[model samples]
Target: MDFLNYAFMQRALVSALLVGITAPAVGIYLVQRRQALMGDGIGHVAMTGVGLGFLLSTSPVWMATAVAVLGSVLMELIRWYGKTRGDIALAMLFYGGMAGGVMLINLAGGSNANLSSYLFGSLSTVSQPEMTAICVLAAFVLLVTLGLRRQLFAVSQDEEFARVTGLPVRALNLLTAVTAAVTVTVAMRVVGLLLVSALMVVPVAAAQQLSRSFTATFAIAVAIGVTVTVSGTITSYYQYVPPGATIVLLTIGAFLVLTALATPLARRRARAAAAARPAGDPAECSIPATRGATDEVGV
Candidate 1:
């Protein structure tokens, strides 16, 4: 309650809530796509964008969002059609962007203190305008992700099948990539570029351990994201710690605990579900039909 009393803390709560919802929503797709490292790639690109924004005297987050979106689209394109290795492409951008950002920052004569804030986490640095920007972008990310859930799921589950089915596989891939980029931007404000992906990926991983289906995992990841964000923010306030690191550490801790318990609990539940099924029913053990009542993309 005391944490909520301060205006900055109020702003932090809102920021955390928005990212908490937005990050894992997009994260589910990234994890499903097996591009979990995409966040790290995007993070490095964002550093370059921030440096350029400082040079141009613009809002770094907006610059980072635009660059990251563009970067993501290009990433999809290269991976889709490039002769070179996809991971190599991502790695090139990852390292090159960070190097460029350093040079750009030096040329721009930007402050080390300000740059450090983006690299790490700094709740005090979040201003009113930044908070509002995070909200708008985060909301947009959530809307697109949920709206295109089916198509996105198809693309991730099997790109060839999705393309054959006339699902606009390329377009859906681009859209999801951009949405993830936007998610990366919003999360950077709370978790910093260095560890933004942890907030996005860790919760989803934790949820995956416990969930038996895609929808259940998605819901659980969002819940975990919110829980960690709120709890970490409050704890950071009282402990005088960096909120971004605090939030991420809590998420990691949750994942560990979930790992310790999910296996046994999942085994028991699986047994119960099997017991509920008739022993002679072969259909119950069969795979679900394409996009059936129980969408089995991840489970």
Candidate 2:
């Protein structure tokens, strides 16, 4: 209880909660669409922006946010350009962004700027203002995700169908990309650029294994994300491990357990349903009758 009185702890908790909610909310769609690696690319871009901020003596958050958004737009543009060759484009963007970030960091003489904080994460550095900013951003993200849920769902499930249905597929894709950028930027505070993408992906992956519906999957993912954040933060505080690594490990562990437990049950249920169907329904009987008629006609 005494630990809760510390301002740093409080801020860390608030930031974690905000990040836990928003990251997984956006991540569910990303995971379904096979764009999980996109977050990692954007996070690296945000890291480059952080270096830029240091070079300019400005707020790292602002710079990182702007860079991440731009990176997202760039990713969407590349995807559009590649069209049928999107995977190659995404790979190019990821490696390109990573190289750019490393170069910028080295050029800025930020070698002593505790870059590791943005790599593995450090909860001790979370401040009050950052927490407030994270809360506001989280709220905005939540509203946007909920407001555009239908379009996002359509695009995630079948982008071609979404295009056919006149859903502004391009615009929606850009929006989702921008959302991923912001999510990565904000998550950097908690998990750092290197590991923030994991926070966006692992929880949703774990929940997907256990959940039967999209909504249920999202709810469970958020729950798992929050639990991992809180538990990891606390353990890291006590054990002196990196919070980001701890959180990521916890998420992975949960995912493995969920996958192992759910696979057998899902298969069993499917087998049972298959067995329960009537063996000689009208449709099945008609198939043989039709075949018999064809055979007689051959005579």
Put down candidate 1 lDDT per residue, 1-299, tens digits, no spaces.
77777899988888888888988999889999998878878888888888888889899889889888888888888887876687788788888888887778878998787787888767766898888889899889988888888888889989899989999888888888898888888988788888888877999999999987889999999999999998888898898999998999999999999999988998899799888988787754556557765565675
TM-score of every candidate relative to the true structure: 0.90, 0.88
lDDT by residue for model 2 (1-299), tens: 56688889888877777778889889988998998877888887787787777777777777888888988998889878978887777777667766766677677777745577776666778876667767777787788777898889999999999999999999989989888888887788888889888888999989988878888988999999999988888887788888888888999999999999999989998899878889875434434534554475542
True-vs-predicted CA distance for residue 114, candidate 2, Å? 2.0
List ranges where model 1 is wrong by over 4 Å: 273-299
Pairs in steric clash, model 1: none
